[model samples]
Target: MTEPILPRIRPAIAALAPYRQGKQAGPDAFKLSSNENPFDPLPSVAEALQHTTPINRYPDATAGRLRARLGERYGVDADQVHVAAGSVSILHQLILATASVGDEVIYAWRSFEAYPSLPLVAGATGVQVPLTAESRHDLEAMADAVTERTRAIILCTPNNPTGPIITSDEFATFVARVPGDVLIILDEAYAEFVTAPDAVNGLTGRLHEKHPNVVVLRTFSKAYGLAGLRVGYAIGNVAVLNAARATGIPLSVTSAAENAAIASLDAEPELLERVAVIVERRTRLVEGLRAQGWDVPDSQANFVWLPTAERTDEIAAAFGENDLVVRAFPGDGIRISVGEEGSIDRVLEVAAGVR
Candidate 1:
């Protein structure tokens, strides 16, 4: 018997690899692969989640209340704030909204692993500019790379995996060179973890006001410890955000997630104290790694990058064998999130052995 033929698939999508999440650890291991908040859900968030009702009903497709609260915080109109399941979901929407066949989306390579694939899924070409030797974006090269076909550019600050923030001065100069029509997405998923004075503060810096084309993406998944609930928001021009909303799936942000996010905001002080603890731990870990002769990047985010290069697989395996799970990019580097305080010693020990 002959088998039935499969329907046609988009060639670009067929060739594209799905986004790979950070590795999970066993019960005995610390899950430092994903840059997640080490603390559990805030009591306020938990209490708020308990009160969620109307389970049979769809969520507010616009996530109005959350957007309003975010708008008040960011000094933007409610229309300028758009909430989605997560910042990543918003990324997909924004890419699809602005890019199309024959368009180009430019971003620094070895930045977000998901950046390259998102454009391909939208039938657009991805143009990756290489990161500098310090594991930071080469903004000059990126500016030179832009062409008439460039539709959007993604700048991930406190950049993922290799954690180094794009300085505010650098971003200002880069933004000036880009075409006014091009959309600039500042992905600041780990913004809350940054304590560096010079780092770009997208939320409060009023970048959107200065650069009408700029849109800032933020998430509760990291600092708020709401990763499982998937709540994030974007701040941008009303028109641009509306275009993103048009491309989004309806009712993707659940009521529970919205409530939890609001509660998290209400309890910001305590949540930020937890962030301070993580920042301290990150400093300790980085210092210990440097003492162990590792060339760790000066990360302002809640993680550090070790440029393991060809030894990435070997070092990652060594970490795994020592019951420490970390994200590894073969022939490149390793990203170890600042997790439980107890896990830091073990990480330093394993890293020391690798050297």
Candidate 2:
């Protein structure tokens, strides 16, 4: 007989529904579900992986070498870089390090689905600021929602589902208005794909210089095409990053992942060329969708978003029936990744018929 397994765990832990990843974007399936890079890892990255020694040994617990390389690339100190299994792990660590029971965590709803859940996992309260009518984050409303208990806030720029970005000036103003101690996470997973002149590259400039409380999260998953390798890092003030590091699980990042990330940085020129293609494809996808009478928003990321929740299921089913899987959020909208040349055409055709 099973002794009450349900009652033995922490209520917060018991209440969590496990995180769900996007559907597999298989080659045969015209997959556009996850917003993964359409290209493969760089040749240098592949070469580095072949020489990765003894998988039997534990990975560098501090991710020291990777941190140094990242520091060099971003112009931040090695002490400020904290590598994790992926940006998702870094995001989770940020929440767990700051928020605790009854404290509030704020972010835009429908931005990153994990944003609200991460706080809940830490036994913290969540505040979801509603998006504007245009499906962009209402930064002013988020600012208004803050209180003494609000410990952290997440800002996913060129935001995940909406694909719209808050300009550098707007972000600067927003950051200025927030309390100094509140941890602000600028998750820039798609930063490499952005072409907007005003778009803030958090690590490359002013945000890092001016805001001590702000941390930028980046990944090799999107533009660098290293999603399967699971390497990412956070850039911030050394003290805050140190705190996050102290709270993070040691040796969670693999040596293979570290090696791949370092190689990706070294191979930036080629990677950026691939990124340019994705940007062009994104423009094509958006314009094509709009020409077909779809209400798509201005996107700065690797994906485009539909504006109405009502059309989400229909659009998804249309693609799925044609062996194209896409991410759909109920009462939110549909999100389709801009994939290879032919895949976008499939998405457009299915989208054209969704009605």
Candidate 3:
């Protein structure tokens, strides 16, 4: 018999590994593998849930009211906002809308794992630019890598594996080099957790004003404590937003998710207060790790990156032994999310033992 054929599957899918989201391993485990908010959803969000009774019906297909609220909050019109199940959903849609077979999607290696996977799923080639030893994106190198075959670029600031962000000036210079037609998806999944004064706030108003190709992706998954809700949105020119929206899966956003996100927005001030605390503790974690002989990079996100080329497995094992489950990429070092202060201290203790 001949082999069964599934034409819809891209050839690249065979080689691509699926994204592995962090999960709770044991009942007593301090699971800091995923970068999620340590706190629960805000009281305002709970109240919104109480008042929301629309679960029996389908949510507003366009998410009009939430889009309007996002517009008012971000200084853009509702047309410029594209909401989806989560930022990853927005990213997947962006790749689907822009790329085709043989096209290239460029991003920093050791950044977000999803960046590489999205391109392959779009039937496009993935171009992974390696991050520097210091764990920052080499924007100049990335800009030079763009060719006529390139369709899009995914720039993750406060980048995933390594947590530093691209500065505003650096982004401006980088954007100038890329051709105007190439789509740029700036993933700011950890924007709310970033304390750097110069952090590029994801091409929202500024980048959109200058370049029609730029789109900023954000989510309520991290700082808002709504990872379970799976809500994210993109801010860009209306045409680009519409193009991305066109590729979305059917009825992706639920009424509960929409209500939760809107509630998150209403409680932004209180949420920001928690962000401030995490920032302070993140600094302490970095300093303590560095002091203990760990080659930890300065992180802008709510996580710490340890640069271990060979000892990645051993370090991850040690953490697991201590009931602290950190995330481990193949060649990259371990990434531990900044949970509660005590949880971070436990990770530091595990690090101390590893050192």
Q: Which number leads on TM-score?
A: 1
What lDDT does candidate 1 reach at residue 41?
88
Candidate 3 segments exceeding 4 Å error: 1-9, 203-205
RMSD of candidate 2 to the truth, in angstroms, is 1.5
Error of 1 at 146 (Å): 0.7
Candidates arranged by TM-score, highest first: 1, 2, 3
> Which pairs clash in the backbone of model 1?
none
Locate the minimum summed-lDDT window of 10 residues in model 2.
4-13
Residue 46, candidate 1: Cα error in Å is: 0.6
lDDT scores for all predictions? 0.93, 0.86, 0.87
TM-score of predicted structure 2: 0.96
Q: Please report the TM-score between candidate 1 and the true structure.
A: 0.98
For model 1, give the 10-residue run with minimal summed lDDT.
10-19
Collision count of model 3? 0
TM-score to native of every candidate shown: 0.98, 0.96, 0.95
Number of the top candidate by lDDT? 1
For residue 193, model 3's alpha carbon misses the true position, in angstroms, by 1.4
Clashing pairs in 2: none
Residue-level lDDT tens digits of model 3 in 1-355: 9998866865568778778888586888878899888887777898777766467777787888889999998788999999999999999999999998889999998888778788878888889898887899999999999999999999999899789989999999999999999998899999888878888986443677678899998899998989987889989989988988899986788878888888888888999999999989899999999999988887999999988778899989999998888898756688889887778788888899888
